[model samples]
Target: MTEDFVNGAAVQALLDRASGLDAEGGDGRLKAIVRELAEAVMRTIVRHDVSESEFWAAIQYFQEGAAEFGLIVPGVGLEHFMDLLMDARDAEAGRTGGTPRTIEGPLYVAGAPLVEGDVNLSDDPDDTGTLYMSGVIRGPGGEPVEGAILHVWHANSQGWYSHFDPTGEQTPFNNRRRIRIGSDGRYSFHSKMPNGYSVPPGGATDRLMRALGRHGNRPAHVHFFVEAPGYRTLTTQINFGDDPFAADDFAFATREGLLPVPNRQGDAATIVFDFELQKAGASTEEGFSLRARAAV
Candidate 1:
């Protein structure tokens, strides 16, 4: 009972701080979310009038659960959270340009191998899927940004990433590639398209979902992280040409504008994606680059 009362004080302190907030620094919108989270935490904590020791034991899962997650997927959630807020913030400030930013999964590791043009991503001898991704990276004027960098990667048939998949041979950047945008902001690569994946079978997300009797599955898609100087970075994906589960993506990562038209062929073929970005400061930074960003 004493412990519960102390927890109540903690809750009130949080509420007090959150309720008195500013839009820019204090973020009034965050107060409601804090309230909801506080209530949830209280619900789990106040259930049995447990002893102080028991309460600590119950709270241990927060750290354990977090440690179970990888670096990539966690950022996906953060990306989504930021995207929602930034969209409103940008609109309020009248900043615009480029396709809307989306989440970048934790699977994105830096320092991929660079190449001039086409990349053969399928490493398995038995694997025979071909996909060609081409595009122009453009600036605010809708003009091409020459020498932009396009880094790409995708899962194998088993829906596993290169660094994580145990079934595949131990090779670094197996399904990854980096391409330089040509004089006209044009870039292209060749690889086997990706398939969708389900959540980790028995983690906190899945444990909660299973207790709530929900299914955990995500739709098929390929991932990309494109970078350029004087422009923000673009971390997005393209769903399989005709994935039935695209709209109902388990992760709910699929967006209408995020989907691209895929051109499949028995023979080698290609499709073009026109990428664009607004001038920095003139618009909110959408696709950030380190080489120039650090210089600024």
Candidate 2:
């Protein structure tokens, strides 16, 4: 049908029933959200006049690529949009000044070995190109933030993460560490340089990107979660400015302040960055979302 039919009383009644609008013993907020979502999808179907075969094919694609949905979320910009939404809210709340938060891709693992000071995260002999990164955590007023913990993880030279690598060559917790900031609020780590990577060739993300005339590639970067007591937890990452995909990240994670230029000498490189964190207004801001994360 058309937009008129999709918005008619008959469809509204069906949606209300489907979303359990009048049903008791269910979440009222969830029912309202589901009804709105159903209405939006129905409008989209009518707007595009999508064929039954096309709709079923799309559903099948999602079912087959369930494993890659995490990547697909960032690939299509939903993840980045979430960051932007939070940023807007923070601005509205008058929170300002700090390292800009960015998308936290679905690769973070919890419980890396904690170190008191500078540490080496790369232990795999197969990894190449030494990297030395140091940074300080400061409060919003530019004072040192002691007792901060920096959780860091990155891919290897071949763009394979430790636990998720399919080749089974990387050791557990390879290129991952939990560094405790010194009393001076400084933290440092050594690791092999990470390489940029593209979406799995011919996979769901790649297929969808190609269909939309886009490339699915992300620049070489390191992920981090910096947190301290009484301070808002910061989720951010640094992309290598020299990488070709640094500015063209398919995940839209390339922020102006996040691209740090690496100073190289021979095969070794160094980067120095600093972070500022606002005071937490509530307990909820002191930790990250309790999303399911990998361990070990």
Candidate 3:
């Protein structure tokens, strides 16, 4: 039987100091959270009987894999947990049902050119099949949500996104755009059919997933950010129903009403999906979180 020292006085004092519980200069709420987190970590260490070498190795892993943390977060389902938490909170507040929110993967770039009505997202000359996607944005009451901006982005057939592709072959903003909704709240775009992609082979995220006996792969999907006045900003994406990984997305982003089957016709495909928005209650819900993103 392993002796538990996590709750002992000496350990408690160490946790308190580590979390700055005795300091009055920092935020009270933050300090409280830190103390709780530190205690929880201590409990885990004691429960697992983690060796000092193992602990240091884990720290070194994080230090070496810091660049892949964004992917790791989703791959390990932390991002999805956040979505579930938000959903539960909304349900508790009686703010139920429009469209389910999902994890916004860390590949979004800022400052896409805004266009009115319809637009073309695939400006590059690629051999991939053409895709025609159209959608309407509506409120909970089924009324059109005018003045909305629909931001869309996706990877190309080679499973490479602009601004992040290592081949240096993609133009800036290759498959990204922002379409402003007209009075009818309709938005549409034409682009190359995106392909499903796996995490970079041999990278930190891929290595971690392999060690966990899991595969880091996402289905062919289109990302969206729909925002309108008086409505909560929606960050979501739709996976292609035909993709093999649609039901097994590593990012856990697939949701009901978000998987649209593509209608195939020769070298072209068509997808029609509608989106519904919930009314915003707080000002913070009116937009996306301010995070560092690629800009050109």
Candidate 4:
């Protein structure tokens, strides 16, 4: 609207301020891409027959999208980006070709019962299943990671995880548990295993997917996240055998070694699962369990 300045050139200046980004000694990757796109926006506005207010409205919409940034995997794509970086590291290091990494969905909560060698996978989980998931956790060198802890959880019957189901009576951290491997390198737990369902279909993730005409369903699977003092954090899932999309998870979570075999034939009545982790940082004389860290 000013005499000397036109409609589009003024907006281009807002993005030009990012030109010195690489000189600041940081990753110039994202900033440079943003600047190029900003120039394109200005050119588009100058060429189109669109009104001035319409161009301003487009900017307003992008502002809204940025303001709505979130932690959900389906939102910013950071979760997937982090996974790719981690997998690359794993490949370079040639550690244990371990389990498949999966999304930690917004539902994973900290703190669960610190039990010994076995868990009962019932709502009132008290030894309901017959099979116990027993195994030894070993470092990348095949040495036992004695005293390390493994956290485990799965959905209750009807495929509902706690804290996410308004209709269910389960508590906030419903089928979750934290167990340390014994000095002998053995660990075990009992729980009715889980089956996966759709990602929350009405949330922002699903809304965006529906707008793209994508299905919001995640295939049947089990979630696992494990950590110990000297090992990298592992987040993964074990998918059931029947899903056609097992190789093509919408979450991109399904990985090799995470898909458990059909032992009980998909029955929640029993699951005898076991896993070993690759070593991470320096092994310290200092003891570490999640509970010990929390007590500090």
Best by lDDT: 2
Reference-based lDDT, each prediction: 0.64, 0.91, 0.90, 0.60
Q: Write down the TM-score of every candidate.
A: 0.73, 0.98, 0.96, 0.68
Q: Write the residue-wise lDDT of candidate 4 on 1-296 in tens digits.
A: 33223335555566666554435665587778877876666556656756879878756655654422332354445666767787787688674465556566555556776777655544454222333456667666667776677777777655677765667577666677777777776777666655556655566556656766776666666666667676766666666655666765666666666665545633333344556675665554122223211110
C-alpha root-mean-square deviation, candidate 4 = 6.7
Model 2 scores worst on lDDT over the 10 consecutive residues at 122-131
Instruction: List clash counts for every candidate, in order.
Output: 8, 0, 0, 3
List model 3 lDDT by residue over 142-228, tens digit each.
Answer: 999988999999999989999899999998899999888998988889998899999999988998999999999999999999999
Question: What is the clash tally of candidate 1?
Answer: 8
**Local error of candidate 3 at 96, Å?**
1.4
Report the poorest 10 consecutive residues by lDDT, candidate 3: 1-10
Off by over 4 Å in 2: none
Candidate 4 clashing pairs?
Answer: 119-190, 121-191, 121-192
lDDT of 2 by residue, 22-116 (tens): 78779999999999999998899889998899999999999999989889999999999999999899899888789999988988888888887
Q: RMSD, each candidate, Å?
A: 6.5, 1.0, 1.3, 6.7
Deviating ranges (above 4 Å) for candidate 4: 1-12, 16-72, 75-78, 92-96, 125-132, 265-272, 282-296
Query: What TM-score, to 2 decimals, does candidate 4 have?
Result: 0.68
Summarize candidate 1's per-residue lDDT along 25-92 as a digit string, tens digits: 56666777876676666665666566789777646755667744542243235446666787789789
